[model samples]
Target chain A: MELVGISKLNADYEAAMAVRKGIKLFIDESAKENFKKAGIEVAGTKVEMISDSQIVIDATPDGIGAKNKALYVSMKKPAIFQGGEDADVAEASFSALCNYDEAKGKNYVRVVSCNTTGMLRVICTLKNSFKVRKIRAVLIRRAADPREVKKGPINSILLNPVELPSHHAVDIKTVLKDLDILTMAYVVPTTLMHVHALTVQVDGNPSKEEIINALESSRRILGISKDSKIASTAEIVETFRDMGRIRYDVPEVVFFEDSIHSSNGEIFLTYAVHQESIVVPENIDAVRAMSGLKEKEESISLTDSTLGLLRGRLV
Target chain B: MELVGISKLNADYEAAMAVRKGIKLFIDESAKENFKKAGIEVAGTKVEMISDSQIVIDATPDGIGAKNKALYVSMKKPAIFQGGEDADVAEASFSALCNYDEAKGKNYVRVVSCNTTGMLRVICTLKNSFKVRKIRAVLIRRAADPREVKKGPINSILLNPVELPSHHAVDIKTVLKDLDILTMAYVVPTTLMHVHALTVQVDGNPSKEEIINALESSRRILGISKDSKIASTAEIVETFRDMGRIRYDVPEVVFFEDSIHSSNGEIFLTYAVHQESIVVPENIDAVRAMSGLKEKEESISLTDSTLGLLRGRLV
Candidate 1:
């Protein structure tokens, strides 16, 4: 896979350089020396990369990727944009769980944001088994990635929009077009994981056991820490380390099994999603999906298997 | 106010005796020597504590409190039992926010359990704001008190009832008889606080701003960490410490402001209740109510004011 090394911010540049091994990264002439010093193999401009490659994954910082649309369209190559890009910027949105069928052979795909992706995974999984009426979620979001020190209030809690449903609900609509959801979001100071408190109302009042069984049987939805020992999200992060995951990336929604409660035909639960790698599996699925190389099931299974999804306490 | 501490477990005895400067304590003959060495004052027997007091607060173990019912009735002394006691054992169940008037002048009063107390506090506060149709909650419970090391699985998640709706729902019924609530409980290995994921469905679809306004206006619900810098419960605890709270105890439910979401007439949010001090103000209110010392508002205001509830980020 080729990378895009834009010598913009310190963090983005360093991130690209760190993962530059065995991949040809597109960079400007000014960043060639820095790339060489960092032992990174450099390629040509974004135009050249688009022309040479069969498909392009636009990971450039938000608006920049969307602005490069004309280049990809001129080359007639399939393009995949990161979640940061606007949904309208892409031809259609893709989540491995929600819209996998529609994603196949797509020329352009915008993978949903991390929170939307996590919610979609659970909602899509459960909607097949139960009659989902509505979804209400409160997102306890991390302020920034661990390395993004320059990107936070550092000590204050600020509400995005400070009113109404946050943009997350609107963003999710790009994938699950018909699903009714209302989301509230808050960015906390910590850079650990995003915790979501979700309430999903189904048609009939099911037993708690039934809800747990359904959620547990779902794909990529991990029922974690049912035992009394593993307590907080902090302990969960430690558990991920114990499992020896690459970069301690848990690519699934870590939900508390005992917290899955069904009453009056409604389900209430809490889950923590590791924001860093939650999108990695979906990105892999999108690649196969856009290339039309594999069917939905085959692509998901291959991606999950390659990412060690079924190996341990994770889904 | 006099405290009647009974010497039983080593920790309980030490706790009681350490604070026995002006208080009377009841102890068995076997533990009398330990109390004497600890420079604690020992009163007559359990019978004497029940006989001499204007109101006997039964702090005994669960079933034991019910077992001592005859002694309290024989003396015609009004008694208050902790939540561990059976609800039927008391003349009326009491929570500061719910049925405080009914609790007054009752000979036997049973305060709701910690989980029930916390739930009642929120439910009673919100019931009037909107016509609450149903409440679905997932209780992330603490395994034991911080000092009670021998009382937990230590590293295992244990589900109480292992089925739909734990005893908390039943207990809450003791207070809010008409409330439609379903609660599932799990004991995690942490003693910090009990976090609840709550979903409330009301009559007409209220706006997110309406819900936030209702909750913020309610008593003893602290909207904490409005800034991104104050992140997790750990940092919230640190904030409490910085505020110079006694033992860093936050008597109210600390909820993230940005996480309050309302859609389709349903509200979703998460809040952490400090288990240790959650009931402290209630106990004070209960005492005043039972003694006929003050009206409900007077008692609650006095209790809140005396506990420094109004001075900090709470109440």
Candidate 2:
């Protein structure tokens, strides 16, 4: 994601030529030329034809761009729209997997930030449940912006990411119909995980255990587990290193919190995402959805295919 | 807490003169000013002169602030250093039967943030049974400097809060010395709950359920319950208001991170606390030390009355 995020597609000859040979995610013409020289299977029409399987991730600077139209037309079989930054994910939006049904033809669904997806899964799980009186999500992001990384000051850092909380709140509502709900997002410069310290004050006084159990029982696609708490920063780093040694086939994306401290006693615990492997989620999830796996079947799919295939190739 | 945070006893005013009128809690003073002209007493040395059954809160700032050193001996009982910001909780920290015990005999101890207390409890519980490996805490702060209240960049807003992973972790170890571990902490500028999305990769791969139960079974200081994966921002606000309606006692110190996103397929949970209400555990293990009230009737020495009082208070 940051590969394309750092800069726009360069149209120059070198960048185009280096496209194919250098890497595969997003290759420009110059880079493509480089790939052609390297003799990689530079398939597809060179005329920049956005064909089927040609997903146009709506990272076009616009928070919400006109990529849905592109998907409606180009998705001859099963196309996708990776809604990166500010793209809205409404209940009616294909991105809302709970409402997602069998597509008559090719379909276009958006995958917003890792933070939004995480928030959505949690909210939607309890949306219809009358237990909750209200819900709020703070999309705490990483310090390094893939598209463009620029350091900002702190006070402004805590500022809500959404220009208008109402619409975005609805965006959360479309998926999570809890009438009494709101969404607040902030971008912090820590890249271990996108910490979303949500506060849920239910209509009735429910036991904390009951609420936590409800969350733990949620789907794996949401990738949440009771095991992940606001981990200590040292533990977070240790977990990151542990993943490599344990060599888990699954791209075990460990979750931890920005759960840190202050002498002032202000509690700020946001989630963390390993900036290096952030895209690991998108790939695994995309493959799972593309492979036609059900909500819970994704794990099996990964075991039988996704992780297996990757491991096999590595060996 | 902000009152103590901002201003200090001016040197211009005679030291005894400042005491003659009586010590007043920040909020008490504010109330006297706002509601009526009856200026109230803050940290008055009522140990020897108590006409009313008033609450004598140990809202003193940090450790050093609590100790009555010879340098400040002229003052009856050294003024308990407290960030007057806690004037918000002045009513509760002192008023209610909140069983909080602080070392009052010329020593220092911390009344931590709720998250700080919760994290300390969580880690200590884990360390008691499991072979500890590492600990880390990433804290997102409100405003590093209380002065800057406006929206600002994430960088400037972040602070490495002191007394986290350390004061709590070490304090726990001081009593429960079963394992060796390392810790780290970072602070960001988001307020409310110090949402901690933690992950404990034990010495071996413990079943997820085992880990959850181990956590839930921990000490009673912090409530460790399960939660849903997604909680919109609205839920958070409503929860706050709801907590207000319930009139949660102890100033309802913590915020719940009902939605700490794990991943496309992960798990996360979190909790928060009002740092001050937390009792610094007796060196670490207060239960074993507080056995005086136990049915066994263990004859425990009452060397540290603060610890004894706390031990006596432990339920």
Clashes of each: 17, 112
Q: Each model's C-alpha lDDT?
A: 0.72, 0.37
Candidate 2 regions with alpha-carbon error over 4 angstroms = A1-8, A11-78, A84-97, A102-106, A126-130, A146-148, A151-158, A161-168, A177-179, A203-206, A221-238, A245-315, B1-61, B69-80, B84-186, B189-315
Best by lDDT: 1
TM-score, candidate number 1: 0.71
Per-residue alpha-carbon lDDT of model 1 for B117-200, expressed as tens digits? 878877887786889888877676666676786896443334454446778988998888888887766555556677766778
All models, DockQ values? Answer: 0.10, 0.05
lDDT of 2 by residue, A1-315 (tens): 122211124444434444544533344456666556655444333223344233343444334345345343544433344434333332123333344342112244554444545555555554444355554444455555433436532222332432224244655554445455555455554434455544444555444344434433444221223345323333444543565733222232222222222222122223333433433444345434544554534433444363332211110
Which lDDT value does model 2 have at B159? Answer: 20
TM-score of each: 0.71, 0.44
